[model samples]
Target: MKIRKKPPQEEFVSQAVRTGGDGQDAQEIAFIDNALFHADHAEDELFGEGSERIEVADWHFISPSCLEADGPPIKTKVLTPKQEKLLFLRYNYARRRIRQAQIRGAIRGTFESLMIWRQRAQDARDALVNANMALVPAMLRRVNCPNVELEELISEGNVALLRCVDRFDVSRGFRFSTYACRAIIKAFHRLASRRATYQKHFPAQYDPQMEKCDLGDRIHRQRWQDSIEWVRDMLTDNQAKLTLVEQTVLLERFAMAREGKGMTFEQIGPIIGLSPERTRQILRTTLRKVREAFDKDTAGPVQLAGA
Candidate 1:
């Protein structure tokens, strides 16, 4: 019996799926069109060159501890200048190949080759990042920020390092560490400045149990109490021209002179020797007279204040 080997494209796809490619390789390949490829070439002619293939097998193994938030400082052999340059060249070259493949319009036939280049580019970038992951912890040692946690500073520094990896120019004749260190320091400074500004605006931490100022509520209650006192005085002075029966009815219905709940129309009706409907009519008339008097009394003070 003979075993038939799968084609290169099918094999590569299977390998990608096993290695957590998550369909992004296909999407990324599909995203590279002629317009973007031409735009990238026009903007930066450097991306057009550097097609030399670089071996990535040596840098493929990234330590799991390097990615852990609470893990100890990552200790990896720093890349020499030659190795650094090669990694950048490989990364950029792989990206260019994807665009070139798209331009050729043979994506289906060249899918395996495109995925290989994409994986190579990603591996090169990851190798560069892992090589310098130690810089974040080293920088944190120099920073004395009590407000920011070590984990948070590390996260910011890692982000800055990744951005530096993407933006650093090997042709500039400078070390990657030099560029990355400056970028990380700037990120830390920005984080500190933002924290300082936030603290300035909000000096204290939030506390759900903290007592809030109730000045508005107190003022509202005081105004309501003053109105009640004025109404009581008006009834005492008979200023609204209330009959004796009307006065008694108002007092009982509202519980103005008592400590208990107010009486209902039925209860007030029996007390005043009238039907419930008649008692309601009398209450309504008394309220209208009180409201008119109160409004008249407040109008002068309001107009005077405005004048």
Candidate 2:
């Protein structure tokens, strides 16, 4: 891997000098520039062209292969113990470099270099993760989780595998697979525990029939019926200040007092001795007056009977 060189700090130094107002600003700028320069030099010395670089190729789990009775074929060339150690070393070293840069306050000036190391760390981590991808399905075969889907288990196992790659200590001389298996099983156990808790709280599977509740609907319908009765009383008592013809048009148009459905303007027109348009006009006018009266009655402050 070719490491990128850090950009010269002189550019920042010159820009700061041009914009700075006093010697204090200039001194601070120079101090920052010197720290960044040393930091860049240290990074180059550590990871530059002379260092041994490990190349990681893209690898993925072939789903069809995972179904085999024996085990899934390794997607990439299986790393030897030495290669695995090197990859882990590189990954952790890159992270340490980033942390050191952050501590030294060199990150702001070395953003590009930091990103390159981050990408290297990610690549190394991915190589380890992909090489061990088969372990997930292999472990899954031994697990019996009837409630969880195979896909969800695989997903959880993959996440656990990635986390294991980050946390495993190659120096401890333990095989990565041994460490990874425990983590993946714990992940599955946690998933199972969550599923158990969820089932405890909600024991029954979702059933549309069982979920159906009509109490709210009944209450809403009763309220609507009461409102309709109140409006009928208003029309009957002439409390809405509607004229006789207006009242007749509204009652017949809406079928409020009659048994059948409401009449259209054309049907109510002949009964009221008016054209359809005229009947529609009377209905609109009656509705507006009724709405005004209803609004006034509802909006007014209520009084106690004695008061």
Candidate 3:
């Protein structure tokens, strides 16, 4: 068989990773646009067609173009493999530049460069978060959480993935997927354990007293209010029947029967220009007539001992 000559690795890879007007490969731009920006619903374009769409708001990805665009708010999304590789290169390149600046004792220069490097690192980290989002759903599938929804599980996993990206060491010669899987699963267990703890410590109890006590308290307040209103209505209705002197005495002595703080005859005597004994006599006479009228108005009127 005739042997086919292999092209240079660099040239072959360069052809595969073609760039577009946005300085990103056209295929990568398409991937990011479809997977992150253009997605109308929570569909998984990352793993290609037939993948399960995690019915949720895709708030995990942000496009670099939107970094300076006067457009709608930028949401975070996962990165494609090629995009991740490029972002990784950019981050590491910035790191090396910062290191070189520091080594040369360029303190002022390093400070300015450090800011740019930090942003580059952030972009790389965000890219990693976007790319490995599928791992969150994958991790959720392995766990058993009866109470938690698949969406919640995925949410927890995404948090774990972001944290994993921050702490991940690329020098370890392992794929980010492997590291993130364990972290996401651990996060899942932590979530389940927290829920278990809550259920164990503060279990839902069918305490009849809770409802009964609240209802009883409300009822008591309502009854007390009703009693006060009824007494005021009774006092107002009978005011016309009394003489001016009697009316003044009743209002001053009983305060219209609102608070049950009826004054003694001695207290009312000076206020009404009557002697203590005379005030007592008038009060006693008024009480009998009022009690009789009150009893006539209602079937369940309170029976006074003397009246």
Per-residue lDDT tens digits of candidate 3, residues 1-307?
Answer: 9987655864443333233112343323211111232344322333336532232223443343332325344333545445554444444544444444434432334445545655655565555555566676555556778866666776788788877765555555566677778888899999988978877888885677675647787877676566445545666776326666776676667555456666777888888899988986776777676666666767433433331
Reference-based lDDT, residue 138, model 1: 65
Taking the tens digit of each residue's C-alpha lDDT, what string does model 1 give over 1-307? 9999988977765545433345444334422122333454532432335533334333343354644556566555777787887677666666667655545443355666766767877888887887777787766665667677667787898899988887777777789898888888889888888888989999998987576888898987676566657768888887889998888877887677887777888888888899999998988888777777767786312110100
In order, the Cα lDDT scores of the candidates are 0.68, 0.69, 0.57
Cα lDDT of candidate 1 equals 0.68
Residue 257, model 2: Cα distance from true site in angstroms: 33
What are the per-residue Cα lDDT tens digits for candidate 2 across 1-307?
A: 9987646775554343333312232222211111222464655544569655656566565665564456654444667887787677667777665554434443345555555666876787787877787788777766778777777888999999987887787778778998999889889988988988999999999999877999999987676566657778787787879988988887777666878777888988898799999887887778778777777778432211110
lDDT of 2: 0.69
What's each prediction's TM-score? 0.47, 0.51, 0.41
Name the runs in model 3 displaced over 4 angstroms: 1-106, 149-152, 205-307
Q: Candidate 2: where are CA atoms >4 Å away?
A: 1-57, 64-76, 106-109, 213-307
